[model samples]
Target: MNAHHPPGQTAPQDRPARLTVGVVGAGRVGPVLAASLALAGHRPVAVSAVSDASLRRAAEILPGVPVVPPAEVLARAELVLLTVPDDVLPGLVAGLAETGAVRPGRILVHTSGRHGAAVLDPATRAGALPLALHPAMTFTGTSVDVQRLAGCSFGVTAPEELRLAAEALVIEMGGEPEWIDESARPLYHAALAIGANHLVTLVAQAMELLGTAGVAHPARMLGPLLGAALDNALRSGDAALTGPVARGDAGTVAAHVAQLRAHAPQAVAGYLAMARTTADRALASGLLKPGLAEDLLGVLSDTANAASATDPADASEGPEATDDGADGGDL
Candidate 1:
């Protein structure tokens, strides 16, 4: 029995008991996950790493493990981790299966948030046991990721018969497993991309605007405000929203549009789009009064129309034109 087995759960003698692991991709996520499995007593047999950084990380995390070709890795491993990019995964699986690399009774797992186990159907036909185990946390290709695995949630998708094994593997890696239907994987991934990836973009935009406004340290300026806003949004959802738009301050919003157009034209579209969406959400959540919302909508519409009407060649000619008397509404 492996030394790290949990109390009261002994390996059965009748079953094949070896837990040799192979990682097919040594990218940011792959090495960390393999290290976590190693911590849970699985032996790291081989890893396929093509890039210099990946090879370096593998050396650091899986010391003394052989860097082998994909087929060799698959041949040696009882558990194979396919951690390539989402776009590259299907082709890799098909290629591996075509070359007779996949074997019966071996557990094949992928770390793509966009795909479920169904993407491994080619390998399934070759008799591999397929499972999709996507960690919800982002990776940095370092030791820190291994520590972060504890208490993290993995979005799991697998065949009914293999559910227990999949969940057990995730638990062994110090992660909780949340089952996701195969059809729902795309939407699940989209939600994470919007929440995490797009959040980075939004923060970048905020910092750029702050810099334009002469803030010497944009990170310091935004850190507390963003942290509190994120905490409140998570705790209270739309009910926690606050700002000029949420408060139905049409005049302040118009002033913002005018200033952005005058000084930072590139930010105008994104600002208006988010503002409109925020207004819609606030209105739906009953956070903004209907009459006030109408006024805010009118101001936004007028600003959008004014922006569209202005010629690109004339952009530097003067301050952006605005609808006559559109900013007359009270807050």
Candidate 2:
């Protein structure tokens, strides 16, 4: 670990004198990251929080850790992680820059998968090394998140001069860093949403429909099935796709639509839309005949639309809210 520390910084006898890291927004990612860095031998010197609950959580989660305001964290640490919600990042950075809270020689990083380092352009112009380091994992609020950091992939973006620092941070946390151009951020995040966020939605919908079908303990039953399906998908790619849509069984799909229409009227449209998309993918995979795919989609579409239009109350109620993949399978 000493050899792994970047040159010019002496390793601490008690803790790594690596860049003093300060975490902003002591929410899910902040405290977990602080703990992970601490476990990795780097000092997480200070953390910032705006709310009482956040401050309490920070203190409770990391006893003896100071929960200071944002400026204090920025002023005290060489590296500052702005882990605030995505919507507030630009404004927060801009506000920090305007107030001269962002210090020179400090590395400013955010954990938003949707935005690249460019979101911190204000801080960059103010002489900070702007960086984006998004860990590809959901963070459930706990010390367990520290352990989960290991072996995950991180999406990193930084200027050439600060690239090594960014890479070193990921490596220190036991993650492999994948460099992405700032301009490609949207598409990258979209892929994450489709794979991670929408997977949660799809799974929750499955569990709900399963419950409607008289399956006891929907979560327990769905867990292993979803796990196996995910494992297969990761190992075999599109070849792992299975079940009625993959098999191009229009009859099964039609029956499913009919059932949703009668029992779980609200889920009918979403089920049909997803089924159509799946059918399209199956068609691309050459698993489904063109005529059969069209016919299946047609049947689903008509039933879904008719059910949706007739029952206006049903349209507003979509699938149950899932974790948005922010907390992994548990969410």
Q: What is the TM-score of each candidate against the true structure?
A: 0.87, 0.88
The pairs that clash in candidate 2 are none
In the range 1-331, model 1's lDDT, one tens digit per residue, is 6455566665432234548999998877877888898777688899998867778988998899999999999999999999887877899999999999999988999999989999999999999999999998877777887998999989999999999999999998899999999999999988888888778889998899899999999999999999999999999999999999999999999999999998888788888988999999999999999999999999999999988887654455776643211110000
State the lDDT of candidate 2 residue by residue for 179-246, as single tens digits: 98999977887788788878888788888888888999899998888889899999988788888988
Residue 141, candidate 2: Cα error in Å is: 1.7
Worst 10 residues of 2 by lDDT: 322-331
TM-score of 2: 0.88
Global lDDT scores for all candidate models: 0.87, 0.79
Which ranges in model 1 have alpha carbons more than 4 Å from their true place? 1-18, 308-331
Error of 1 at 142 (Å): 0.7
